[model samples]
Each structure stands twice: as C-alpha cells, then as structure tokens.
Target chain A: MMNKPFENAIDAHGPTVLRVCRAVLGMTPDADDAWSETFLAALRAWPDLPDDTNVEAWLVRVAQRKTVDVIRARSRQPVPVDELPTSIAGTDGIPHEADPDLWSAVASLPERQRLAVAYHYVGGLPHKETAALIGGTTEAVRRAAADGITRLRTTYGASAAQEGTR
Target chain B: MMDTNNTPEFDLASALTVGADEMDSLRSELARRAADDNLLDVTYRTIDTPLGQLLLAATERGLVRVAYEREEFDRVLDTIAQRVSARILRTPARLDDVARELDEYFTGRRTTFDLALDHSLSSGFRAEVQRSLPSIAYGHTASYGEIAALVGRPRAVRAVGTACATNPLPIVVPCHRVVRSDGSYGGYVGGVDAKTKLLTMEGAA
Candidate 1:
C-alpha cells in the first residue's frame, strides 16, 4: 500500500482534531493534551496504514479515545482549590478567542448529544462514522447532533452571532 | 423520524475555529514534540533558488535528499518514504541551517556547506564517489575519469559518470564539478541547463 508521509496527515487534519477536542473537552490543557496524544499515536501507526484509509475519520477516532482517557483521568483528580466557577462569562478558564458562552452552551449539552455534535459537526465526520465512534446507529447519532444544535441555539446562539462567526 | 437537517443553522465550526496563528504554533509545537520523541523520521521543506524551488528532506541523521522542482517533489517524497521511512513531515525548522547555507552559496558569500550530510539515499560505489565530490572545491571542474581515479578505480569512468548522474545530494555535494573527459558537462540530475547555470554561477564554466 502506498502510504503518504505522516506530516501530510497532520496538516490535513490537525486543526479539525484540535477543534473536536476543544468542542468536546473545552479549550483547556485537556484539549491540547488530547490533540497531542492523538497525533503521536497516529504518527506511530501511519507507516503501515492502508492506502484507502480515510485519514480524517481515523484521526477523529483516535482523538475520541484520547479524549476519553483525559476525561477518565480528570474524574480521578481532586478539583483545584482556585478553580474558576463554570458560570463565569467571557472565560472558559482559558484565554482563547472563541466565545466562552458558546462553549458553555456546548458544555451544557448531555454527554451523548455533546459527543455527537463534536464528532459529526466539529470533527466533520458523517453520522455513520460518528455513530461508530460513540456507539449508536446512524439515525440516533443524527438526532443527537440535531438536538444538540437546537439546544445551543436556544441557549447561547445570540452571543455566537453577536460575537460574529470567527 | 425527526428532521435532523431542519434544525436552525448554527456555524459551530466557525465559532470554535482556532485562529491561523494558533494553528501554526500548535503544528510547530507538535513537530518539536515529535522530534524530541524520535517520532519524526524525515522533516522536509522547500526553498526557492535561482534554479527553482528545491525540496530538502532530512532525517535525524542529517540532510538526506535535495531534489529539483522538475523531479516532481511528490515522487521524490514517495521514493524517500519507501527507501527511508514513511514517517516524514514538512517541517522547516530542521532545514533552516541548510537553507541559509544555500542562500549564501547562491549569493557567492559561502564557498562550502558546513551542515551535516546524510548519504542514506545512495550506497556502495555511488555513495563512495559522491562522498569524494565535496573535495572538488568551488569554481573548479573535474572529469568523470578523474573522479573515478580519485575513488581508486581509474578504469571505472562509466561508473563514475553513473554516480554523478545519480548523486542524491547535488549542489551540496558539488557533483556539478564533474565534467566529461573532453571538458563538457556530460549529465546532471538537475538537468543540463541547471548544471550550466550552477557552473556559471561558480565561475567554473
């Protein structure tokens, strides 16, 4: 099988993976850590990848596993004493350019709906593939993503538009 | 069945998009992390030269492949991936020194490259003959027969010609200095016109 250099894979899909991580885990060290871990894992597996592999889908799958690992690790850690309250406006506890309100709205989504949105919308995977990543039928995954979007619109869609599409 | 597509449109990706600068830094950071972990097998970048865009690829060992634009960079990358390792990236940081040296050489401010060389792309007699090319000096030309003799096989002039024609590292290794017995530019991997331009630039023609 003719494999491409792993760098091409990184260039083509790194931003999408980072976006998915941030959308799912927030723009925190957790997201950055997940992104790094995902690519490092991909780089290790890149050489032997089949020529017909859909690289973006593969990376998003890897990112899902990495994100899950981060989440499990976080659950075991004691909350920091100086942790910022989740209700704060204009801050997701990180100095990123994205609207904290929108992220907060995304954060407010149920686990299944949030994952479905992050994978199918932000990660740019089709419903079938996203279903495979998060465990459901394609129809269920599609409904979860739509429900997540409808929730976000009712919650913080005004701030997202006011902030202007970045 | 709920109409999933009928939900009011919201641009989630645009709202969540990382800025271009942030993406650049993230990629650079990952490259650094990969290098530190020994996961980056080949890092490459392109530099514009008087001839054309030159594709420079390196391993942790050293600079390995220098290819001309006409070489179809994609094909060259495929060759390196197959012959070396498939773990290659287009990172400029590893090639900064070589790019600087090439710039200096093209402007006549530098006479030789001080960068480490990687000869993994060539082997056996061809590698040996190419290894002997750097000693040919700037602003000078040597015959194929002379190079064969220099490599301790005077009767292997044809082999020397093959070596020069296939030198994986060209201008850096100074294969342009090898001429025909009758004082003509026999062949060059970068094409004969590029050979002449390099010779004229070196004032060897």
Candidate 2:
C-alpha cells in the first residue's frame, strides 16, 4: 500500500481536530496541548496505520483520547478556590450573567454530552461515527447533541445574538 | 439561527471555530517534534530566481534534489518521498543556506558551491560523469564527447549525454557546462533557456 505522506494527513485533519478539541476542552492551554499531542502521536504511529484509513476520523479518535486524559488530569487536581483566599475571584454563587460565554456553556455540560456535541457539531462527523468514538449508540448521541445545542442556545446563544459573530 | 435546508437552528457552530494561527503553530510544533524524534528524514523548500522558482530538497546527508519550477515540484517531492523516505517536510529553514548560495550564484557574487551533495540519483558511469563536470572549469564549456573520453568511455558519448540529462544537482554539479561538440548550448535538465541563462551568467555564453 502506498502510504500518503504524513504531512498531508496533518494539513487535512489538523484544523478539524483543533475545533473538536476547543469544543470539548474549552479553548484553554489544555486544548492546545490536546492538538499538539494528537499530531505527535499520529506521526509516531503513522507508518503502521492502514493506507486506506479515514485520516480525519483517525486524528479525531486520537484527539478524543488526549482530551479525556487532559480533563482527567485536571479533575484530579484540587480546585483553585481550595488553595486561594475566599475573597479572591467569585467561586461560589457566581452570578448567572457574569461569564455568559460559549466556553463556559460548553464546560457546564457532562463529559459525554460535551464530546458528543463537539464531535458532531464542530468536527462535522456523522452521529454514527461520533457515537462510535464516544462509546454510545447513535440514538443516544443524537439526543445528547440536541440537548447540548438546546442548552447552548438558551444560554450562550443569547449573547451570540446580542454580540453578533465575534 | 440561520436555518436553511439541512441547517441547525443555533449558530453556536461558529463558537468552535479554529483559526489559521492555531493551525500554523500546530504544524510548526509537529515539524519540531518530527525532527526531535528523528522521524523527518527529508526537508525541502523552494527558491525564486531570475529563471523562476527552484525546488530544493535535502536529506541528512546533503542537498539531494534541485528541480526547476517547470518540473512540477509536487510530483518531484512525491517521487523523492517514495524513493528516499516518506518523512518529508516543507521547512524553509532547512534550506536557508542553500537558498542563500543560490541567490549569490544568480547575482554573480559566488561561483563555487560551498555545500555538500548527495549523488545517490547518479551512480557508476553517470556518477563518474557528474564528478567529471566540476573540472570543466567555472566559466568553460566541454563537449559531451570530451566528457565521454574523460570518464574513459570514449564511445559512450550518449551515456555522457544521459548523465547530463538526469543530473540531480544541476547548478552545483555544473551540468550546464557540457554542450554539443558544435559549441551550441545543449539540452539542460532545467531546459535550454536555463542552460543559456547559467552559461551566460558564467561568461561562457
């Protein structure tokens, strides 16, 4: 099998993986880490991958694994408020309207819902492939994506309308 | 909500947008990681000259291939990737010195190439032909018949012509210095116009 050069794989799938990561990981340093790690790992294992493989789907799978690792690693750490004085940033009863951002809205979702929405909405994967990546049936992922989008429209989508395409 | 046929209601899809800056940084990081892990076996970039853009490639050994713009650089790179190694990158810094030297050559500031070369593309009689080219002098021309005899195969002038035709390092190896016995500018790997250009620059035209 004639292997396509790995650089072509990067060009084709890098942005899609980045979008999926930003959705699931919320545009933080963690998102950048997930993007870099996915490509790095792909380069190392690239020669062995089947030539006819769906490269974007392969990269998204790696990004999903890396994103979950970052989240798990972050969750294991103590909350920042636990270490700081209570008087600092508002950690408790934070106002409903303070940070009405898409990132926070996405962050508020359960992990599976966030990933399902990200894979389908941003990565533009079909519900079947998104379900396969997330270890759920297509019907479950479909409902999760709809639920996630509905919540975003109610919360962040209002700001999007007010702000108009920033 | 820009609802149209097969469109979703919420415009939150744009929120997941990734910028070109992010992609650039990611690509550079991938190049760096590939180099550090010893996976990037080939690096290539293109240089612009009075003739046109020239594609330059290098392996860990030295400069490997230099192609004219007319050669369809994408196909050249693909062939190199298949023949040499699939670990290819279009990183310009890897060819910075070579490009600088080429700039000097075209501008008439330098004549000799102070760089390493990979002659894997030519071997046996052909490699001997390439190795024989430098002695033709910087501003002198030699006939293919002359080169054929120099490589000790006096009857192999056609082989000498083939060697010049397939020279992987054209300018550096000075393949343009070899011409027809009648002193006409001969076919160049970069085409006849490029040969005339190089020879004219060298004071041989």
Candidate 3:
C-alpha cells in the first residue's frame, strides 16, 4: 500500500482533526484526548484506507465518533462559554494582533453550528463531509456554515469594519 | 449607484480571515504548556526535506502534544504571555541543543537520536511496542508480525499494528522501521508518504 500517502494525509489533515476535536470537545481537556484517540484510530485503520479516499473526511468521521464516545461516557455539563480556556479563547489567550470579535463570534455559535463552521472553514471539509460528521444532509451542513458565517458577520462587522476604515 | 454609507463594510469571508492572529495566540498558549516539568515535553527540530521546513514540538510523556510548527521562527513575548500559562517563557537557548542534534541527523551526521526520551504516558503493551522499535536498526525493516513476536505476543500482530499506529514519536522512535510481512510498507502516524520517505531515506526499502 501507499504508506507515504498515509503519512502525507496525517500531516496535511492534522490541523483539521484538531479543529474538529476543538469544536466537539470545546476547550475541555477531553478535546485533546479525543484528538489523540482519533489519530490513533486512524493509524489502526490506515492500512485499509482507500487510496483515493477523502482523508480529511475520514479523520472527521473518526474524531466525531470518538468525541461522541467521550460525551457519552462523561456526565459533565455541555461546555460553557465562560469555561473556554483563554489560550483557546479568541484573543485573550495569545498576544498576536487578531480580531477578537470574529473569533468570539465563532466561539459563540451554537454547538451544531460551531461544529459545522469548524468543519467547513477550519477543517476545509466540503458540505458533504461536514454533513457526514455532524449527522445531517449536505444541504443542512451548508445552511449551518452559512448561518454561522452570517452570525459572525453580524457580531463583528460593525466594529471590525469601523476599525479597518480608520 | 448605491450609497456607500448604506453598504455593509465587511462580509463573512473577510471577517473569517481576520482570525489568523487569534490562531497564533492559541498556538503560543499551547506552546507554553511545554515548559511544565510535569508535562514531559521533548523538543525535536528536524529539517523536513520534502516539506522544506523545520519541525518542532513539545510532547507529554506518552506523546501528548502541546505545540508544533513547521518553521523555526520565534514568537513575540506578549503573544507568549497571552497563549501560555505564566510559568512558561521563551527558552529557545535551551531548545538549541535539540536543534543542534537534529541538524546533525538531517545532514547525515547522526543516525541514532542521542537525546533523552520521556515515555511517561505509555504503559502496558503500548510501551512494549515503543521499547521494541529501537532494536530494528537503521536501514532495516520488520513486519508487524515480527514486532508482535519481538514483544512476546506473536498472536497479537494486529494489536502490534495498533501500537505502531499510536506511536507518539515517529522518526525518533522509528516506527518507520516496521513493515508488512508481505514486503508492504504499513501505516505510519505521520502519514503514509512520510513513512515511505523515511524508509527510502534510510534505504530500508
């Protein structure tokens, strides 16, 4: 088999996997756990991965399944906005000059919408793959991504645009 | 023509692009975790010949990763503060040792990784696989079944494959040394191509 292609898939798709884990597990430590588990799962299954398969989508599917398992095993509350670690938070965790409003808006999206947005924008999955991960149709994923983007626009457009204009 | 005042100044695509700074902050915060003594961080700097970038990261005892980058650039101090816990700080001078050794290896000057490894996170059979991998030697390959046999679990060849899949460290630990019994290159945590390249580079193929 093409072992090299498998390695390339891991490198190229690593961030997307992380983003998917982040979306599902929020900023909780479990997110990291899930991320590890997802890759581990991918490693075990890589020998069987179809040569022309969408590796990113495959990773997302594995990550989502692992995340669901974690969620099922735990009895914790759904991740709270306030509990998001500053490091993972939009601008509060780092010193780079980024638009806080935009990230906050992303962080503020509802869980489903947030996952959809992460898969679409951050993970770079198309609507079909996004749907598969989130358990919806392609059209539904498109709508969620669109809606999430719309929300980001509403929340950050006014202030960020004003700042840009000056 | 529409009045400029009535038009929305930014769209969704433009807004999303503005979050790169936020991602940078997140990366720095993640990097800070590497400094904790309890974190079991190992920094490796290697010239990735194919990607044409240097790779570095801090990992926990069993390879719980904190931060990684493809470049050798340093982060600004303020960014570090926001991303990592206050306990973490710029210690590039300390990391330089790793850089030096990695540089040697990339230039064909070093073969074995002489640095200390923190394998704290691994236990049971998984740890066994890690322990067994180093014995495969440079420029040699073994099958998953062979590794299983080496670990005293010949019946667990598939399980051995699982362990390799979960190998936290790739190049240093040399999971690339493992292959299929049928002369096939098996799975690699870094991806298949990376595995092939490592094998090809080492003349294992």
TM-score of chain A of each: 0.79, 0.72, 0.71
Cα lDDT of candidate 1 equals 0.83
Please rank every candidate by TM-score, starting with the best: 1, 2, 3
| Clashing residue pairs, backbone N/CA/C < 3 A, model 1 | none
lDDT tens per residue, model 1, A1-166? 5467777777778888988997778756678789988998888888778889888988999999999898888878797422312332222334556566877778778888989999988887988988887898999998899989778776665774676762
The candidate with the higher lDDT, 1 or 3, is 1
User: What shift in Å separates residue B97 of candidate 3 from its native position after superposition?
Assistant: 9.7
Model 2 chain A lowest lDDT segment of ten: A81-90
Error of 2 at B185 (Å): 1.6
Ranking 1 against 2 by TM-score, winner: 1
What is the lDDT, from 0 to 100, of the residue B203 in candidate 2? 96
Docking class of 3: incorrect
- Mark the 10 consecutive residues where model 3 chain B has the least summed lDDT: B63-72
Model 1 - which docking category? medium
Q: Worst 10-residue stretch by lDDT in candidate 1 chain A?
A: A81-90
DockQ of each: 0.51, 0.28, 0.05
Instruction: Give the poorly placed runs of model 2, Cα more than 4 Å off.
Output: A76-110, A149-166, B1-5, B8-17
Q: For residue A30, give model 3's deviation from the true position in Å.
A: 3.3
